[model samples]
Target: MSATTQDAVQHHDHHGPEKGLKRWIFTTNHKDIGTLYLLFALIMLFVGGAMSLVIRAELFQPGLQFVNPDFFNQMTTLHALVMVFGMIMPAFAGFANWMIPLMIGAPDMALPRLNNWSFWLLPFAIIMLAMTLFLPGGAPAAGWTLYPPLVLQTGDAFPFMVFSIHLLGISSIMAAINIIVTILNMRAPGMSLLKMPLFVWSWLITAYLLIAVMPVLAGGVTMLLTDQFFGTSFFQAAGGGDPVLFQHIFWFFGHPEVYIIILPAFGIISHVIPTFSRKPLFGHDSMVFATGSIAFLSFIVWAHHMFTVGMPLAGQLFFMMATMLIAVPTGVKVFNWIATMWKGAITFETPMLFALAFIVQFTFGGFTGLMLAIAPADFQYHDSYFVVAHFHYVLVNGALYGAFAGVFYWLPKMTGHMYNDKLSKIYFWISTFFINVTFFPQHFLGLAGMPRRIPDYATQFTDFNAMSSIGAFGFGLSQLLLVYIVIKTIKGGEKATGEVWEEAQGLEWTVSSPPEYHSFETAPDIK
Candidate 1:
């Protein structure tokens, strides 16, 4: 055997993972922490999915059958919070934990103890968030945006929710710092920034975005807390604080927050499309530049979300044009993916299927977003179901679907067991088709003037709303199949090879399937 192989084994496997529950609570291993992040995200996925079901059921017949308006708002608020905070973002972080060090030829994150702390913070934060629901006056119902005046009046859930958000923000900041430090300092010799994998590149940019913006969210929410208790009037108009200032601050964080959830998805797709297409990623440098541009643009487009808030015409025009400008870099990404597929020996694995669907559906969301970017056109779409449909298309089909693609792409390697191909494809098809059914009609309803965040609507909206509810249920059930498929693969199935996908590029595929508890003991030279 080569000296290098022996050295790798000696260095990487010196202390493998400990056994049982103690292994989890006290572990500093990156793989272990990544697994914890994923498991937590999975559990949150179901919890948030349940909240969505409540919403769908209530909106099913259009008369609020199951929940009253207050509870209905609670469902909406919690669903967005849990899904965005608890499910999507952490899932990406989980991927970062599991794959980043391996991809960069590092044995572990730069800050392993901080990694443990960041992940552990989530469960407590989630518990605090959940606790808010059962205590006194129910969960915060001002939507995930948590705009002021209305937010100040929420029940017992308010303080807990704010505190939970603070915990989450702190956790996110720590995780981002770990990612930045590891990516910057731990890469193998000969691996320069330009040569890094797209996933790593995507992450570096996202970490910066997180570091820059999450504090703003924390501060905004803190001000809300102060308004609630300390008698500050940061958002109270009667006290001379303009409520719109809160929108300005919140969206500053909020818009970038959307990109934080999505940039990793771009990284995931960059890898997946290349693997299935059996070719190098097209426009590799361009993808990097485009990602950077998107990150930069995310900072300036925050105001587009508040076009209805009565800003000056000049401010409106500036934000309107800035929001539309984002489409350029975003469009470049979409173009590169398709170009990567062009003239390649393509195969439609489960991951590729989802990737292809993401291109179509996510672009659809982008188009709608552009429509909403027009200051004039937004006047009509603002606060309507159209806005609702637009974001879900992006979040659910874009971020969440991209996540599904990544998980499927890496599942075999992670589990060392090939999932049921038939079942995986079935899960994909059901999820894609029903997701459209669930959210597509909302576009029509919004154009027909159906306002969002309301429990009941006019009779004209009944048919579409019922169809959406049915689709929501179907989409919700489809996820169970994914959960089952994941379990079945992990328990036992066909063993996966070191290179799980055909010609899957990067240092990660060079590692063993179900890589050692401590991966990459010795850094690999990136030739």
Candidate 2:
């Protein structure tokens, strides 16, 4: 290396992370905090994956072979909670911490200390969640919906689960507040809201959603705690309260919570598609507006999840229409992505491949979602494996795939070294292939009348369940390749230049790969 660049790096590291664990504990640096968030998410990814594998294993032959029904329920419940909070949400936040400031030319997050609090809070929350496994009742197994009466039956573990949820909610709200403030106030000169990167725009919408919904979630759970212990009637059917009220509150938070997990993914797709296609994102303004519209519509469509709850026909129709309208904005995004790729110099790089798979699979999930939105049809699909198939399509292939694309798209920039292109591509296709195998059969099973969260099923499902189990193992194990690729790139590889991708756009690509510890020390001119 040139002495000049070596000296420059040394100078940058002077105030950077120190040689021990303390660098992580007391540090306020956005990059360090971002690294911590990413690593934590990785840990949770494995934890959640293990839970899912167990679930698949028990369901393999569907004969009560591996685990009993209650234990099986525990696996399913913790798997959803762990993946949603410990893995997917944090994964997005990790990317946000690492990329947002760079994209918008901010010196650092507006609330760096709060960022640390948010990151640190996650471990404690997840630990509290994990602790439930050892409690008397073996975790809250009434399904992630946590409907009362059943949830109230949870033994000593109930408090732990509720408290864990509250902590995670607190973390999300704080992170949202920080992101909103940083973006609203921190953009470099001339970087207007419209001119900022789509990622920034995506997160802005997500932050608003988080702020709106997380507290409602906390309140709902808190009410559950009071009802369970304090003899309140908030969800007690015999008392003056109603159980459906809990569904209303939870879904109010839950529907937007789904978007909170995905909007950042849309942002990731926007950036990745244009880059690999060697084109600008089509209808950028419309993309931004579409995201906002989806957020607004998310609040109204919560009832789509509750169509089976005997709502009046008028109410059901309203929710069904609102849910369907979400497709308009979502469709705009899909078309814009396709248009961005149309007739362009497209390259099926690893990120592009993942992004493409995400589009296709997530769309399939969306179709099922629309079907479920039909209040009449939902009677047949609700709580069935079809619903399971729809969400995994949306989440694993949709949100998680975007996380994969973002990691690969930015790994070079994050590490100052290019990942092994061939191995990464292999990882991508393996995951893509097996993920389909794992979830696709469930669509048929759902249609054939298999309910979710069951430990055993009829003989007719044996073959498909076996295929799904095999696929689940393959898909779950293949993710470690990502961990390996990331480590290999960091330890040593082809040294990356400032611009990792050839046609990379925005301020992020303008800086050094593995950009200095303190990025944007002096803001760059946006124009």
Off by over 4 Å in 1: 1-13
lDDT of 1 by residue, 1-527 (tens): 26466766576457767889999999999988988898889999999999999988988886757889998999999999999999999999999999999999998999999999999999999899988889888999999989889998888889999999999999999999999999999999999999999999999999999999999999999999998899898999888898889999999999999999989999999999999999999999999999999999999989998888888999999999999999999999999999999999999999999999988999999999999999999989999999999999999999888899988999988999999999999999999989999999999999999999999999899999999999999999999999999999899899999999989999999988999777766677789
Error of model 2, residue 173, in angstroms: 0.6
lDDT of 2 at 505: 91
lDDT digits (tens) for residues 142-163 of candidate 2? 9898998799999899999999
Error of 2 at 33 (Å): 1.3
Best by TM-score: 1
Candidate 1 residue pairs in backbone clash? none
Candidate 1: 10-residue stretch with minimal lDDT: 1-10
Error of 1 at 187 (Å): 0.2
Q: Pairs clashing in candidate 2?
A: none
TM-score of each: 0.98, 0.97
CA lDDT scores, all candidates in order: 0.93, 0.92
